[model samples]
Target: MSFERLNQINDYRQLGNTNLYVSPFCLGTMSFGTDWGWGADRAESYRMFSLYVERGGNFIDTANHYTNGTSETFLGEFIGNLRDRLIVGTHYSVFTQRGDANSSEDRLRKMVQSLETSLRRLRTDYIDIYWIHHWVFGTPIEDVMRVLDQVVRSGKILYVGVSNTPAWKIAQGNAIAQLRGWSPFIGVQVEYNLINRMAERDIIPMANDLQMGFVATSPLAGGILTGKYNQLALARQISVSEMLARIDCTTARASLNQEIGRLNLHNLAISLELMEIARQIDRSPAQVALNWLLQQSDITSTILGARTSQQLEENLGSVEFQLDMTQIADVDAINPTDSGMLYGDTVYSEVQDILLESARVVDLNH
Candidate 1:
């Protein structure tokens, strides 16, 4: 539980059911370039990357259109010698070319073009994990699976993943792919944190059942878990409902069929609890929040994003300690995730007891 331990390497584990062994934490490169204004510049990006690499982290996450392509470009420059050993993943399907019909409309062709562009940007021949970014309403899953299978066969990408996608779609798509003997999604990426446990309702359970690598993104819930918003909440006197209604939802969250919510009174209360827990444990609020995600048996990896070496240094400390069951229970009690209808402990067992009491069938999951 010291800085010395943080420098040591944690054993690499397999990602999903694949042979691809990855770090417990994935270094998110969304902040690798300053083109987004809030991101890091070349020097600071290098510092953060080196800090993560030195900490024995290798799994990296990026997107094709991040910072208008500067993120991949910066990572390309940074991974020069370690490219072969590193797990470089990138996302596509942002479609930011605006009115360019061919590039923006067709998902299949666009994925192909995006893969080529990302390969060049990352200065690599093949991406370790190629994500579809998100699911759109019109894009047929059948076509997607087939095309991605073809892409994998071509050796352009090692494996496929989905982000910001619904659990049912993932199940259906994978079932179809398995039946057709095509490559399916081996992992899923979703925003999960102390405040937003929506992923737990369906996505996490589905991932656990399917053996898909579940990578939790936005582990801090848009910096809310860092307790920065606690002071802002103190300054702004508003009701939880009013605060949520007044605030704007980010486009990404809205597009993913997520609740149009953010740092409201309820969320701020969670932030306060996080800070209080950190104070009692003598750990950073970020570490407290990050460790909770790490403890989830289902989460294969949590994305750590930082704009500076100092931030990355602090995030790396997340693995140095563990959250006791009491602390975890306290957090859960204060901010409980809803186990909605038919999910979690809500369904199945009761019905099965009555229907199959005479000769109950063995649980497939067992």
Candidate 2:
């Protein structure tokens, strides 16, 4: 479909089974401040925020530890009067105060303290969605679920989500919540992109079976799928020897070189194929990559981050067009998910045939 025929940013979707409606693209505020020396400044951050809100984007994501709390502070100012109209989501379990024993735990005390601090920094009364940034080993799953449920009951949070967690843990925690009459996780956030199909092995399937929303982060694979690094390597004509020599000099350059080196032949092939598809469609590689994630089933929304207004604008254009089935299939063919040991094509087909006993299996969506 043409850009002109694409859906507007305001075409919202229900977050899981909740009553809340949010934009297809979530505005990630990780780069809201330059405390990390690589983020956008306050002025540029506000500009990006204004532009996104003006374009009908209503979902904003932040974390307590992001930019050392500057992200939440900046968002507090940008969202002054519009808080009632937007869905604000923030995470905890990663940030902590010095000398506070319970600060880093997922227990009741830490969750409460963290939410209070986040609320103060965000200049809001209640959070729309609260997430446990990551699983804390040794912490009881029941404790986490119960505290989250308590917060939801107290109106401190409207919904709960989990990020950077395993699929089996998510399933176990949610099942416990259901049995105990506590709040279940309505959404999941994970690293998903063209280069990383790990989530497809379990997370995506789990979310589908549980009827939960899947929020994808790093859909650009840390900018690898953008094809910029490939262009740089080609333009500079840097040989392997020269690349190795430079890696021993500057730390930043060495890091970049390492990241580029980590991109195996499969990754490079996907990047090249994505660029070719973008060229044929007259769109940026980043846009094509984001659109590809958005087109997947069970993907409720993808979080987008930018260091400048220009980058944000380019990313917002991802929803301007839809990839045809052929284009999508071609992309999928290059990065097919790895079927597990018991679920290979032959084994799965035989199992299905024996189970169905000559009955035709129909795909509902088709």
Candidate 3:
């Protein structure tokens, strides 16, 4: 709130338990291309990339399927000479090959093929971090780990990360890798934000326990946390529901609407509280929301996505200030998951007490 302008971007933080360092925020390139009709053109994308690099941002995230491959191609051009200085991370397991049913398979063959294509598109010899885009139900965890380990051994990818996977599965895979002396996943990417605290129930804790880096995607809740929908609707003199109805029925937009529709009364109340806090602090709602994520101890870095330079600059300002304990508690109080009896802190604490009390008891005979 009313934070002094950051002369530059925040200092680098270690990526998980790895020696590699990345900025406080990773530049997400999902909107780097205009194929989606809602993203930045090549020139605007280049400008955003230049500004981020100029401000000392070195970590950039992109998926092979992002924008039909334009995102990776554009990033390849933008990072020309700076390749050595930046930590380039890209994901796989999403089909980009047209009319290839087998391409969707996350087997060793598909993984290799996908990595090869990503390397060619990015114009790089190796990816700093390679992520499995999502978990495939039929694939064996051992096979995935073995292939990932082989990729690391081949010097094709420096590290492996998993995204959109269940906590127990990742734990099992990593344990297997440890026993086999294979490369374990060093990072985790997941949808994490004020509204989507579901990750906190398991994913976040699992990553912390395993010493894996946690990267939060959709930290803005698909722009809802920015309060843009309400502002845009108000500007057009329409109700929120009416504005949402006017959105194009593209697959991406529909998915976003589905996520927003999940917002119950508690979420709306939290949004209002967030807006009030932003007002009291004299900061933009987006900045306040992002700052809260950056302040989280479990988050190694929060991914920031923007289609324009102004939006990117505003997101960059998030790292400039700290949210005090009072502000954090205020926001925490309205969190959607905090009210649940099964998952709330109250029950967790009680369970911990019971476990600790049981641990302290021992029979003299034993």
Q: By lDDT, who's the top model here?
A: 2
Candidate 1: segments with Cα more than 4 A from true spot: 1-9, 96-106, 232-260, 341-366
lDDT of 3 by residue, 69-169 (tens): 99999999999989999999999855324544344436577889889999999999999999988665445689989999999999999999988777887
For each candidate, give its TM-score against the true structure.
0.83, 0.85, 0.85
After superposition, the stretches of candidate 2 with alpha carbons farther than 4 Å from their true spots are 1-6, 95-105, 239-265, 340-366
Residue-pair clashes per prediction, in order, are 0, 0, 0
- Pairs with backbone N, CA or C atoms under 3 Å apart (clashes), candidate 2: none
Q: Rank the candidates by lDDT, best first.
A: 2, 3, 1
The lDDT for every candidate, in the order shown, is 0.76, 0.79, 0.78
Model 2 TM-score, all chains together: 0.85
TM-score: the better of candidates 1 and 2:
2
Write one digit per residue (lDDT tens) for candidate 2, span 1-366: 112223567888788878888887899999999887678899999999999999999999999888999999999999999999999999985633454444554647777878998999999999999997766543578888988898999998999999877788899999999999999999999878877777777888888889888899878876768877566556779743343454343433236436445444556668878888899989999998888777775678889988789989999998778888788777777677776632122232443333333334355556
What number of backbone clashes does candidate 1 have, counting pairs of residues 3 or more apart or in separate chains?
0
Question: Per-residue lDDT for 156 in model 1?
Answer: 92
Model 1 lowest lDDT segment of ten: 1-10
Give model 1's TM-score versus the native structure.
0.83
